[model samples]
Target: MPDPSQKRPVIALTGATGYIGRNVMESLIDDYDIIALSRNGDAKDNEEHVEWRSCDFFSFQDALKGLRGADYAVYLIHSMLPSAKLTQGTFEDMDVILAQHFARAAAENGIKQIVYLSGIIPPHEHRDELSRHLQSRLEVETILGSHGVPVTTLRAGLIVGPDGSSFPILAKLVRRLPAMILPSWTRTKTHTIALPDVIHAFQQVVGREDVYSRAIDIGGPDVMSYQELLQRTADIMGKKRRFIPFPFPTVKLSRLWVTLVTQEPKEMSYPLIESLAHPMVAEARQTVPGISDGKITYEEAAAAALDEEQKKQEEKKREQEEEGSKTPSPVRKLKQAVKSDVRSVQRITLPEGQDAIWAGDEYLHWLSRLASPLLHIKTTRTGVQQVYVLWWKKPLLELTFDVGMSQSDHAIYRITGGRLLHAKRAHNGRLTFLQIPNSRECIVAIHDYMPSLPWVMYKYTQAKIHLWVMKAFGKYLRRWKHRSTTDTKAAPRQAMSQHDSTVR
Candidate 1:
């Protein structure tokens, strides 16, 4: 619990887009302002109190800005399966360099504490016997603590989540492989935790003075072998595996085989295969209220993750159906002077109603991307008007569109003014969002009159444009559904605050 006397502390979270980081953000959002650091780039839309900061973790100066202005900075970045080839030493060496840079920046920024999530070490810690993955975790922990800020290290074993790397790999193998050619490594005992448990553990350590500057192990209560985990997961997935133990150890060969079977990259599979030999179990766990109490069983965890995943899959299917229904029908088509100039396509409905507001946002994002590869867009809001400046290929062809009276069900926009005189000729442009009679599906239609272009050219060109936009819009809807589903998995926070500032 945070002290009521002090203001809500800001948490600078690295890897905010990662599995653990995202979950942690959702878990602690009510208690702290979040800074989501990601490589691909964070959304620029101003979220309430969550500020997204972009940083190149390798460069101290680059990370300095993002690390600054925070009471606690959660270090969740790791390169187990490095996306890029390492020119210097190994992944461990790169990890150490990154950690040193982060620590330096954090100390300079006057960060109160640093929380790091690391891989769990086996019950019996042998420096010589530690896997490369485990060794890297320990080394990074030491480096972060070496700096001025107090470091809270929470080491976890296999994390089971819907989209997590480990559980899916095991589930996929069980689902795909007819029978298991079990290797000796399958018998190695390791602790495993549900994704929720890991999130809980991170939150539990946030401002706890007792846990600060100490290494703590966190895992689900159950400890089991790889074979048991595989079998139990298979059972939950309703797939039975016939395991036959094989005495052979072809560590290198297995990596290639896993890549071939699982279709995962060597960078990801190689490290995972190499790390399987170690028995990863926690030696001791810190007693935290939410984390250490009332643990769920492995079977229960697997079933719960799978159940939630199944719901998401179903919701996505519904969203797809809703998007497919948006096509304009023959009756909805405008009769133009040239028949070819007017094209309308329409199709069918989902049982659950999709949010009209979200559909509008999707349409906007789709429209912003539809026209050209070289096009750029700038959006600003003034009072009730949404101003969009579109540069089509060249600055000379720039168009400024002013959208007014926009609502969940409909919106009206006109070319207002631009460098091109012909744009002013465009008028009465309206996007109507209609809900299917009794279904959750919505039909979004955009019909505008552009008298500036020749009727013949307008007809065919408009049809082509509509077709492309429809295809692109379908993809955008899919992405939206995916993102929304992922957000829900975080279990949300009341009055959640996210910074509108996004980092890429």
Candidate 2:
């Protein structure tokens, strides 16, 4: 037990970069002196009161260095990476070995408590290969308990959050698809907890003195079927989805299907699909004191996940814009003085005769080509040219570009409204539509890729790449306009609709 008179306890955290681990880190930021451990070294050089250490979890000696001088150590590491060489047949064996290693290390370091976030398994359930993941989790719980260092294990089901492996994929699939072919397991009941709620549970365990060496099940207010979850998510997304549950056995096929749809690695999806095959609803009526009462409802948890996903998409779009603006185009450089002057000088002109007929045509053409691979571009005939200009209040350069190969096949592009536009792509490849304000001159900026190669080695190579294509197209169009000698009029522009900008 931590002495009340002592200063904040030094707590070591494993899996600091993981989804659940990140939430725990944020919750403990001001409360404990965190010693964060990850295979990748400390992300930043300086974290106030947080000591960042790098460790290879597979190596006992390496992991021990991070556990030193820690009162409580959170062991959140799991072997979910698809590329790991461990056989699926021996997952439980590997988990036992790892847990023993961690337990020994914590005991040697004189750590007071071993806090672990584990999966919940209902008592009396049939234990099979599908339930192996939970069994392994339970094995770790026992291993930690044997070490004499009290362990507090918080068992939870699917963690609902933007970054969570299962929920984000589920939410995106529900939002994007109008119909789904669900497995037989869709009828199986499961429990869920919001990422925030899971973090709160950990905080409670960390702060409580009487809570050691216990395995507690934590869940949100509802225990619903997989089909019900899908329906609720669909309702929130404002989409009607048809879920057809075939009588076919789905362990193998469903795993493959999830892998394709979510683009999550096979290793991660396999265990999850197997777990879902069994009903994962909580059986125990007892709850952790103080922590369980504050649990959120399924609807609220779903809403939080959706909100976080939307925010993540917006942030990714901003990052892409910033990256795009930094790499200057050769043509942009030539017109830099004029371009800078144009921002301070705004004017609208209308073309005469047939020339005016194609005023919106060129902007639409540029927009279509620019967002082509990324968005299903379209235009409206209402003589409206909606432009959105976002200037950085700071000195940072902004740029955006599609990171995937093949424009038409890219996940970032999608259709919205009657016009062609560049929709935002979250860092995780979730697509979102941008609401643009109406303006005569809207700068649709994109980031160009800057290679890490030597400047001389790749400067011209970079110039000849995608940017060259855009530059050449722009130049040819300008020449065509000059030769035609037609006067074109700018169309009326409108600001972004308030309704469009707000998420319901």
Candidate 3:
């Protein structure tokens, strides 16, 4: 219990921009003076009690400035990006460097304790690639402990909430996928905690002194599989979803499929899928009283997510209707005309002796080539040396091709250029195309109706696809040079043929 008479602690928190860190910040705002550290330090300034500071944990000396006069600091930062360009070192090594720096900073500033959120890796469990993520987290915990700051480490899994990636993606997938062909790992058991429970756990860590310098695994009352969680989510959403489990499951492939449908980043989904392969249920049967006094069931968590999603949808619909009413009919029509075209082809002519046209064209091709990989697309030049653009609406699903399976049922393709445009989706095992005039460029957008999917994947895919399409247009211009050369050579032959025909 928090004592009213006690002096409110000045707490410095890292990862204030992240999902979990956001929630932790919100919960602790009224209770403590917070110096929130972020890479950009661009969080909203509405919270009167919170002071934002920019700090790169990679540089400890600068980050330590924020920790000065802090009573407790929360380390919620994790480099989950598989492609994060950290200094050439092991994940643990990088974590150790950051942790040591943070610890030294906190110690110099007279910080009393460090609170960390980490995933539980049960004793005797084999350390694998997935375990490395958890190991790095634990390494940071140890580093903080070595600084003589009392460390409270809470190990949790699958935190269910409105803004969290785990539940949102799961809920979206369950709602969007009417019939799910699941991997064998779908049956593996894991524990999950609700967002409120997670917040409460953090609150307990901050208020209690006895629990300092210790680690505890926190979970809900029930342990279940991904399949079970999906079914429960469907039930909460009032939808019936069929889930069929395959005997042999490849989690990597599964992760790719989810990435396509949900638009979650590959780095974020990879650890999740890999961890699901192993049972993450708690080893001890008894619950820790200090952590969770009452367990929130999976069903309840699903219901909360569903409720939040519905509320958001209603709010969005209202906003759209209000905007629609405010626009004049002519303006709306003009906007539609500019935005709708589907298929566009432009031809360019270059001077016989100059290469500027070809150079400009090649620049476009390079741009598209660079962007295509980010969308997980393979680019190939045709025999004509012309660029041919072909991509699925959801490119992440292409990973299923590795397993000889295709998401033909879920595939969508949209092509729009100039004044012609078409959007097609697979329905009844056939492509159903929707024609819209004035749509331009191929913007491969995932239309997941469910709110559970991660937004990062969608934004990243959209950005990559737009960049690649622009590149394709650039390549098309360069191809014109070859056509011009051929046309010049054929000009004399055509004239001679016309003269010979006339004489005959």
Candidate 4:
């Protein structure tokens, strides 16, 4: 055992239980003390240098506490899976909210550097043309660096691991199907990286200052087509399979079949399948030095992944047998509950020189105007904002400003008590207006909100209306931004014309 008196740098790592995060933490366990952030806020038994902290990325306070004593941080979060039972936003929007909070918290806590795992972004003049999954990754990379923290971004293509989402899906498909129907996308060239190599790359760059704020592409020695990857996996498994080439690329149909065959959630598979058309090979200019040596080949990676997966299956079987007589844990029961909380997020362009406080104030007033005939909004002397529908006895929704947590660039409003909210269970529910520091983008988000109505009723009525209203408000903000710019430009011309008249 290492000396307890010796000091080691504490690295605060998000997604600590995820596949890549678990591997990365294990790789660096000997050299660094790690603050592992989990939603459940629990640590494993007998972890020598690891401290577990419960962190909800949706809450800035939680993120701030999680990174409090860390010298550096690692961000490996992806929002493809739903956080709550009822999530009413796109995965991209959800990812943005989480990134904004984490970035701000990291900056506030004086973290020196952040190492982020991201997906490779193909060369595109218009970022809108990129797949949704890759686009979110790129956005996250930008946000992590926006808070004045040096972020080392390692972008990888398909990571071949023992039991992750992407590689396991591929392996399952190969093993289950006797004959594979190959689409045109199967010919797209992409790179692959072994899990061990990825962990090695992280170990090299996490504390290094030279590669700070740089995006590095990590991959295996071989850049092969997707069809070749499938074939290599088949060869490793010693399975005879026939591939029939279909000339057309229909990603929508392909994603469905892939999900069905692999038994993976569509949330995970769809974005990946959508990205198969893009060539994801790494750029030579973005490669890291010295770390490229001794990279594993695809064949070697496939064999090792298969062996490891088999071992994991055996272990899982033994554990299941042991736990057969035991009851489910409370956390498991909570996850299985039908009525879950709600999270909604939307990004809006902030007008020039406006802050989050202005946005939050504008939203309250604007909402009243938008629903003028139906709803009435009022604010009390205590700064509690309430929304009432047609002078009903009770307010539909009530928002109390959290002054202690609110800042110039960030505003927090707790969903205190309301007729439309499940007040008893809405302990953490809040509405936040977040202005990204040094940028014109802002996020309006609702987190952990539970509705008073039944789940199905709320899903159809309140959820749909909320989304529609947010979209309209987003458009309204953009129009305000455009009008603000126009008015500013017109003011200069108006002054010049008056000066010319006076001179004449």
Candidate 5:
């Protein structure tokens, strides 16, 4: 028995409402108090030993506030699903921003360690050619430790869980499809782990100083191709699913087929299907003690997942019957229907030795010149930037500098209000110019921007124009590399110091 009077350490968990997060939070409750962080924290039920706190990872302030008073943290955040109605960047870029904020916040709050769940990376040679999904995972893993916080990274490939997007999609495909064409990518070998094993791994690692800053590759007892995984799932479910060998690794067709047959959104299926082409088997050297000794096989995992899924469905049905005629709020219904937020992320080459501050200033100056009389940028006395159309007094967009969030390497401008934006939204839309460290590259991104125009109209007009502008800017930057390094002088301003007054 434990000491009755001892205070329990709090473990702050990002993605606390997610599938793995829910399991981990429940399993570890006996050992520690859980600070469950979610976007809709106020709405989440708080049980004993669990406290819900709203956290928007994109916001550094929220990240810091959420992690306060927590001894350790579990980072299970991924930007696969949009957090805003109008997310304006790629998942990879979005993941970068979130990781940076969380890592920095953890450091500021004096968090002892951060346990991150990531995908198993392939060998060195194939890393360069990794799928976007794996690449994003690697980027996140790197960023989490950048703040000097001891990070315990558990790298997993396919997690066999009942509720998550991956396993459920596979289970649905096997149950629904009588016959399937197994593409060449499906032959690639990968490791799988049961959901419980993953939860146990988190239990073992959180606050374990010994495993701090160590990365352990974890998987189940089975090492098999995706084809084998599908077939084994079918066998466990007692279904007769057929497979025809597809000669070509047609990932596009496979993605579509998986989405169509499984009835999962393409957002979930596309990246996963693309990743099947790679071998995701774990290496022997990265394994540690308790986590490596996991005994669940693929078949066992499949059975458990299917059983849990059945139970979940029954529970959901029961709940529906208990609450008859309950309806979602009108605001929620409106949000669901008008979720056509625009997200555009582009990577442009940074001139050697130039930082994000310099790049941002140059962008404004360059845009003013490039668009000329048709589109011009004007700066307010308060340093806010406004874009104007030909002879129009009202600005097309308003960008206010977020001094608190901006640094030498990263510059952030909040889209406070403009004629081109929706009146209300979940988050403050922001434009960021980030210079990646130790590399001649920068990411110019827009996030959570809800366009005022209809989705169809904005997609065709402003969206296309934005892409074209970024592309042209990229080409122009590349041309600077060949010029006499004097282009830096053209920058009209520098990034405000961190101590500068912040503008709301």
Candidate 6:
């Protein structure tokens, strides 16, 4: 059954599910056999081309599991936008640990080449003043190279594409804001690259010994200011925006503003905001003829990216329509599949009515606080989806989401960063109170979502903990009802005593 002729060189691609990684695999799958790594460990029968590997890079052993039998291990993984719960230290620390493990694994597994994508840093004169994100990227690059692995680093700035961290935020910021309340960071200049260009750069360097253990800066032909990037993006989207550069430094304030306007979490926007303050450009780009010839202008890339995004939206709409047509009913509903595979749903019927159990906003806030002391639950409104940001005090990881509801029914529960890709560790849950038309009693449904990992972790550790929480939640509802009943009884007794005292 084995075909030796068709067997290609295996490329273990970590962060394969990421925006850049997905594009890279799509482009390179024909040339190389690919091992796609996902943090969630998700695999389905219908997934095509690449071989899917489920192990996340959180553990050295677990991360190393996917790299076996591969000729080249692409380090697309990074911790830019960290997920729900980060126990201690910054993302910088975690990234260094991941690189050390990856380097060790590659050395042991006989993987010859290790290609990494990193953030663009300032030129040597200003390198020390690079932002936290850029600094973290440099640290990761340093760690990845220390094991004597032939690591080729492709340092890119302001990747402009669909589903990428940079351009989407810009497109959104322009569309959302009539006037961008810009700051000093807006004037910082940086080189930009198209998605296709970056992938081409990745493909060009395979098995090339000359470029080994060296850093190559990659970007589009055009270099522009951060403010110009914003304006041009706005122009591409057919919108005009007014800009006001504030007097103060924008590193911190810009983060807060982006989040407030776009509903993007600080985990993403903060690093980006910090990086925007620096003038990030390539120190050395390809001077050779063929490599430099293919570069696109920043405006062209933005326009093309916008067009691609629109087409994708149209395609998604068509698919949703087709799916809806196949399953037709009087009360029809469309829903998005939960992003995670680890799911738990529990239902309970309460004796009290939906109104009695369904408390107001104040009560909801109180319940959320009491349910988890670690959880700091807050909400933001996006034009499209309802956003909820949950920060677990125990772990610094914050789960920020844009929760969407189905058209007909709410079977709901749901909800990436760029390359230097990310791992999402989400534990999203909600309680819904329901009242049937005829029935007096109310129904409560508990739905939670998380990533599916090892059998022991999913079945024993995570599932059990979730079940216990659900049980405690039901108990809280029962206690609330009892307290309400007791208060009602005491009110009449107190009223009678007051009347008697007044009569006397």
Number of backbone-clashing residue pairs for each candidate, in the order shown: 16, 27, 15, 0, 3, 2
* TM-score list, all predictions: 0.61, 0.61, 0.60, 0.89, 0.89, 0.62
Q: Which residue runs of candidate 6 sit more than 4 Å off their true CA positions?
A: 1-7, 46-49, 84-88, 125-128, 285-294, 317-504
Tell me the whole-model lDDT of each prediction, alpha carbons only: 0.63, 0.59, 0.59, 0.83, 0.81, 0.62
Over 392-470, each residue of candidate 2 has an lDDT whose tens digit, in order, gives: 2221111121122101111122122111122232211112111111211111112112223444543345334434544
Q: Model 1: number of clashes?
A: 16
List ranges where model 4 is wrong by over 4 Å.
1-6, 43-46, 325-339, 436-439, 481-504
lDDT of 3 by residue, 313-337 (tens): 7987788798875433432443443
Order the candidate numbers by TM-score, best to worst. 4, 5, 6, 2, 1, 3
Q: How far is candidate 3 from the true structure (C-alpha RMSD, Å)?
A: 20.0
Worst ten in a row by lDDT for model 4: 484-493
Of the pair 3 and 6, which is ahead by lDDT? 6
Report model 3's TM-score to 2 decimal places.
0.60
* Candidate 3 local Cα displacement, residue 65, angstroms: 1.3
Error of 2 at 82 (Å): 4.6
By how many angstroms RMSD does model 6 differ from the true structure? 20.0
Tens digit per residue, CA lDDT, model 6, 463-493 = 5765676556666656654334344223323
lDDT by residue (1-504, candidate 1, tens digit) is: 777578888999998877778889999998888877875445454377688877767444567888878889999887544322112125664565567668878988999889998777775668778777777788788778765789998877788887767787787788799797888888888788888888888888898888889877778878898888888888888876898888876667767777788776565677777788888777745435565442767788888878887897798778779887543322233121122112132211312345444454445445656644444344433212232345343332222222222333322233343332245453443333433322355544433323345655644574466567666675555455344433321211100122112211
Clash pairs, candidate 5, are 86-341, 88-343, 88-344
